[model samples]
Target: MGRTVVVLGGGISGLAASYHLCRAPCPPKVVLVEGSERLGGWIRSVRGPDGAIFELGPRGIRPAGALGARTLLMGGDRSQTQHSFARPEPSAGASGHSVEDWRGCPRPLIPT
Candidate 1:
């Protein structure tokens, strides 16, 4: 019978909260309750009908922001996102977040 912190949603904020909570000195039983099948709710990538990986709202991967940095501290597609972290979005970053064509290579699932 220990303390438990239930984090609602699997979005960036929720993920950050859960991650930190579990990393505390005496971490609690952090239970991340996400509705969807995947953890990353808003920060998601989907394939188009033509087999192109399209990114939705990419705020989570941008390293400029605090939360994004925290989430990225958990590790993201840094190769594709690092260069664009300081750069503003919607400014010809069409292939910036592409998982398949990351520097012309395959993106690893487990963060190294």
Candidate 2:
């Protein structure tokens, strides 16, 4: 049997990793594990009864660059997410993370 790449979180990073891995020419098995029932980790949005939208956590898409953004935007099931990968959350422009932040973030899932 082929080796499986077990992704520990189902957040954007995890999902993105899975996406790229699946897209590879010799793609291996991928298993994503998220602690919470939802996939987006702390990135959440809640709609009020009066029809207001609120985002509670990391709220934007900061692509590494143009090509990276294009690669992510290019192919996918647009129907389900409604172009979510490219769309930043409400008030996203005000605050967000940089590529360096993402790179420096610790991988809580991988064992030492």
Candidate 3:
């Protein structure tokens, strides 16, 4: 048995946190909870029948280095799976931007 970690929400942060916890040398048991059936928080995507792609969420992630692979005992490595979203280039407009600017802020911050 190992330490148990309860993670609220199934958003990217929550999922990644749980993943890191499970990947630790002395991994803990992680339980992730999401209010709705869907996960990914602000990251979401869908493909049309004609093969057009539509993104309904925020953008991508860049691993500082090669991300560790996740595998299943019964199955195989999941790390090789193709990611649906890739980091997009910074756009001139925040509305057209796939992700927040590298400076850690979105463009055109509306004054509260």
Candidate 4:
């Protein structure tokens, strides 16, 4: 008989855990127990006026231990997505600034 793995909750972490476990060399019988009727606790999507789909939840992620594909990072104008809360990044070559070019500190620290 194969091993039976019981996963609690249906959140992102729980879902990911069950998925990876099921894909292992010796796959196990995964039993996901979600308290709520629906899975994907916070991974819900909303349709915009133009039919564009958008998901809400965690803002950023770092693939330190896993290949993080969460958070929809929209560069450039945010109006298209109706996310006015996000400000656009500086245009490339507009400021003629480069990370390598350290133009000194802010107003206070600079010598007049």
Best-fitting candidate, measured by lDDT? 2
- Runs of candidate 4 with Cα error greater than 4 angstroms are 65-112
Preferred candidate (TM-score higher): 3 or 4 = 3
**Cα deviation of 107 in candidate 3 (Å)?**
25
Clashing pairs in 4: none
Per-residue lDDT of model 4, residues 1-112, tens digit only: 7799999999877887887788789999999999998787788755666665555654333444324332233222234433323223452335665422324522212111
Evaluated at residue 35, the lDDT of candidate 1 is 86
Location of the lowest summed lDDT over 10 successive residues in candidate 2 = 103-112
Cα lDDT, model 1, residue 67: 60
Estimate the overall C-alpha local distance difference test score of candidate 2: 0.64
**Where does candidate 1 stray beyond 4 Å?**
46-54, 59-72, 76-112
Each prediction's Cα lDDT score? 0.64, 0.64, 0.60, 0.58
Query: Candidate 1 or 2, higher TM-score?
Result: 2
Sort order, TM-score high to low: 3, 2, 4, 1
**Local accuracy of candidate 2 as per-residue lDDT tens digits, 1-112:** 9979999999878887898899889999999999988987777866666644556787454558886676557444444333222242333344654422334433223111
| Error in Å for residue 33 of model 2 | 1.4
- lDDT-superior candidate, 1 or 3: 1
Model 3, range 1-112, lDDT digits (tens) per residue? Answer: 5689999989877887887788789988899999987988888877666655556775433334334233222123354343333232555354664344446433322112
